[model samples]
Target: MASFQIIIIGTGIAGLATAISLSQKTQHQILILESSSVLTEAGAGIQCSAAASRVLSSWALREEFEAVATCPDFTEIRRYEDDELIGLIPANVNDYSTRLRGFPHWLVHRVDYQKILADAATTRGVKIDFGQKVVAIDVDNVEVTLASGRSLRADLIIGADGIHSRTRRSIPALKDVVPRRTENYCYRALIPREEMLKNPVTATLIDNQSQQAWAGQFKHIISYPIAKGKFYNLVMTVPDHGDAPLGQYNEPGDVSEMRQVFKDFNETVQAVLDTIDSCAKWVLADLPPLPTWSSPNGRVILVGDACHAMAPHAASGAATSLEDAEVLGLCIATCNGIADLPRAAKDYEHLRRPRCERIQEISRENATTFALPDGPMQEARDQIWRAQKAMLEKQLQEDTPLAIPAEDMAQQFPHPALVQWLVGHDIIEEARTHLATRKEIHNIL
Candidate 1:
């Protein structure tokens, strides 16, 4: 019954970023549909690594981001049992930004970040339809049918929906592709900064402005400051039995029971848990790698978690999604007309798939590292961290740039290498080069 040049499903960060990016390049009419009646964030904190920060800055959101995000001085890894420091990675925001011409790694509440993207989307005149549940889609026809029986067509349809993407099922090839349990569940909690400062156990962490993590047998806890240190976000991940009913990602977990899981943790970790008045339990799910991210016809495409959902171990989910949007926008803008949509869609998938797959694999591996039970493997990992820390400290003493490319880093620091691979990438520039090469090839052909 309605039409547009582009229809983006889901209004999360990815969807909004896509709309904004596309609108900036061309006057394509963009519509974003959300199943929820309201635009809100149920998630907790999110990391905006250097790559994502650069994307946001390019969108003229630097001021907005600085207001909502905190740049921690460093990240430390400690043993969960006795809290012995294993490693410390200097996260000097200023130094990195200056050397790389990129923004610092930032921590922010999810809601605040979403607000920034949503505001940017609206300013770009992207139409957003809330409470519109897409029940079915026809990728070949570039059409989607709403639960209310309304059908809409677009020149191109983008599935930016989250992990449980309904739009993903529209592609016949992905109909059977469902997200499976990663056997990890998490308790996400946010503590007010004032409250944290009041407690002696949490005060030192807050005072240092350091992001910290404790690795134990079969579990880990990550804590950091967000909202410019107005609040501290803590995420605790542990193995679960996949007990939640089908179609359910989380259930209300009792605070006492949740605290008990970390009962044997170090005093600081347990103390932090004790202060948690409430928390949300989330079961981590990930999609097995798909053979393709787009339909054969290329009229419909998947972006963000729809195509490469992964465990949150590497903390690159949002960054990858943002990169996907940047690439997708670049592809669409290269199109000469509606007739070129299919080719452009194919280009987007080609440019994005490999990197996304690598991210998914690394994130899964990182989850294993975090939840490794006490054993030789865990001890080896800790030793690697200690060696890397010593190397980093030597570099600092020698007054050298702390930019160690993943390939150049010690083998035990694979997760950091994955992270370095992510933050060091310039997706926009990559997209430009890719499209430019394609343009030459097209002309020759």
Candidate 2:
């Protein structure tokens, strides 16, 4: 294998994970360029589905991850008005073992997850340069110009700088591609477990280490325990009322307005809100699937939010980013020399684009489903959840396998098949198979 220099822009989850993956799988010198002077303790909660867990497991960060993460037993969807249980998605490892083969769903603080990835990447010999803002990219020459007026040349440049990526803008083909506002804003808060334990109504939430989503008209709330159950993460998504400009991602939220918006919600929800002294409001936005995720020369490629940003409804954004890193690493590791880099980049995009596009669509669809108004559509959606819940209860009571209609199961949020496709997928194996087929075809030609 030929030794090559690979520069990854940004040190977010995607960038760090890519560095770690590449360092582990290939002999390339992986360098990460972070625009920030130092990594700040920012971000709220992130739900890591089995798909991401699989990737993390391969990176040998399970012990480190589990130390700071919470493994939710299950995720429950409930009615916002009365707190009625609408549906349940089992997330216990024991349940997954019998179903999806032991991959677990994790609730983690984003800061903790990033630290783990950063540590792992550094431990594997990946060098990270801070305050290196990439201002321009010369794809033909495989070079990136930093804001400091210095230029660095590499065999490959990965634009993982995120939604407002300068590297992405430098690509002529992606000049018109931009992030579209979803017209939804979210309030994020973290409540100490000690506060929640003081109230009997809220105490039950922390008892089982389960995730809960309160679904209602034009809004929804998803909450889970993170930081090893020391704090509870809460995110309230509502219709955007133009409180903040699209350019500003996070801002101070008005606690009074937040409480008023959900005042009609059940007592349990109010109890959770009462504990919030302050919160951050984030405007939710995502990019449309680009015409392509790579430059025409294939030397500059986009990963994670830079290429396929999506709404948080599906909780697969981070997971998909991890999948990108895993697949891209596997694809690049197949190259025997610099001449194979372009083909490797093309293979990575071909293997990743469709899945990412589909997940983006699903996430938008989920936003609609989660905020359906009180009407026949909402009623029908609720009915589907009720039927599924009843079926599961009966199956548990009888200890027998009952026929579950595919259509009915498909209507449930986070549909079983979708979960299987997202979580049960083996990206590494898929990438290897893809590379092998391409090699065989090339030989035949």
Candidate 3:
């Protein structure tokens, strides 16, 4: 029998989710390597959309999230100038029972989510090794060389490293791929729930279970409850085209500048801004949709930001990565621990490239609309978003920006239902037909 061990680089949600999803399906051994001497995560919060929650709920994390996560009862998008509630995003039964169980978003601490994912992976028999940096991946032999000079040979290698993934750049096939920085800077702050509740402007049920997203001419801010209602997390987006590589938090940010970013706004927003502590700025960056993330050889491939990275427009980056994990796992489940590995990698890219590319486009488009200048475009967009709210609430088919034929979209994500089906049903014939004209591009020698 061929060896069936899988090696994963990184320990974030993407890495753990892959190990967990694949552990139950095959007898394959799984190893996850993280570079940190100890766990170190960004000081921020992550919002799990309905689609993302759907994947997690199926993984049986629904109750755990409910216990520690602050469920948002409503999602409100408002205008920056006057703070008029643009429209409300409703959380209904289908969204609830299958995904978040009724909440559109969950305000979760980064550390909390990481712990839960790590624990889940361990329970599934995944061997996790910390403090090992993956310096090189020999796709030809399915081996990985760590920074410490340890050699690891596996049936497959998954690079879940972040935006500046060393494994991605190491692959000659992905040599020309470049990550693009969006013309936006994200600033975040965390405050005690009691402090926010004490502010008269946000004192009202703002302390309750709900999320607030406000759009302005050139900036945006998101605030929601977190830490089991003990603290609140806020992230504000401001326009900045300056040169910065995801700047670190060291020098303090001017409070005036932070306030001015949303000065023409609501009293509640103004009040919240007054409480921000400095040293916050993340230059948003994303990779263009690649036709393939697989390597020139079949034994190695990229996952998470190492592959189809998207802007945090819909908070879909991690969600999509987890999806990629599941599908990749399914492909490897067929591995007989032999030379069948090449065929498995080819099939994996064939099934994934189209979908990840589609999601990449959707995520980019969302960024454009969200940052639309204040003018006719904004007016038209407001109308469209309101309609989306209605459709999502009334069970009507959402009217898309353009009428794309179902066949065309089939190359990637054809519909929201497909996302759910990716976790459930997939007809093999459709996949075979789709990749019919496709050759083994990733493994093309």
Top lDDT prediction, candidate number: 2
RMSD of 3: 5.6
Q: What TM-score would every model get versus the actual structure?
A: 0.94, 0.94, 0.84
lDDT of 2: 0.83
Better of 1 and 2 by lDDT: 2
Between the candidate structures 2 and 3, which one is better when assessed by TM-score?
Answer: 2
Comparing 1 and 3 by lDDT, which wins? 1
**Ordering by TM-score:** 2, 1, 3
- Tens digit per residue, CA lDDT, model 1, 1-445: 1233789999988898888888776778899999999886865788887878888888888899988888876688899999999987666534753354356778889999998899899899999999999988888778999999999998788999988888889888898898988878888888887878888888777666778989888889888988877888988998888775534554666799889999989999877887788888888888888988888777788888889988888788888888888888778777666667678877788888888887777777777787689989988889888987887677767877656564322223344564566676777887787788873334210
Report model 2's TM-score to 2 decimal places: 0.94
lDDT tens per residue, model 2, 1-445: 5678999999988899899988988888989999899875456889988789888998898888888888886788999999999987767624542355346778899999988999899999999999888888888888999899999999889988887887888788888777888869899999888998999988888665889999988999999988887888998999987757885666889999999999888999999999988899888989988888888777788899999989999898889999999998887777777777778788889999988988888888888888899999999988877776676666666755433323221333566666667666777778777777873333210
Instruction: Give the least accurate 10-residue stretch of model 2, judged by summed lDDT.
Output: 402-411
C-alpha lDDT score of every prediction, in listed order: 0.80, 0.83, 0.68
Off by over 4 Å in 1: 1-4, 97-101, 402-417, 440-445
Give the alpha carbon lDDT tens digit for every residue of 233-319 in model 3.
Answer: 777777767755562432346667777767777877888777665536677778886656766666677888788777666666777
Count the clashes in each prediction. Answer: 0, 0, 3
TM-score, structure 3 vs. true: 0.84
CA RMSD of each candidate after superposition = 2.9, 2.8, 5.6
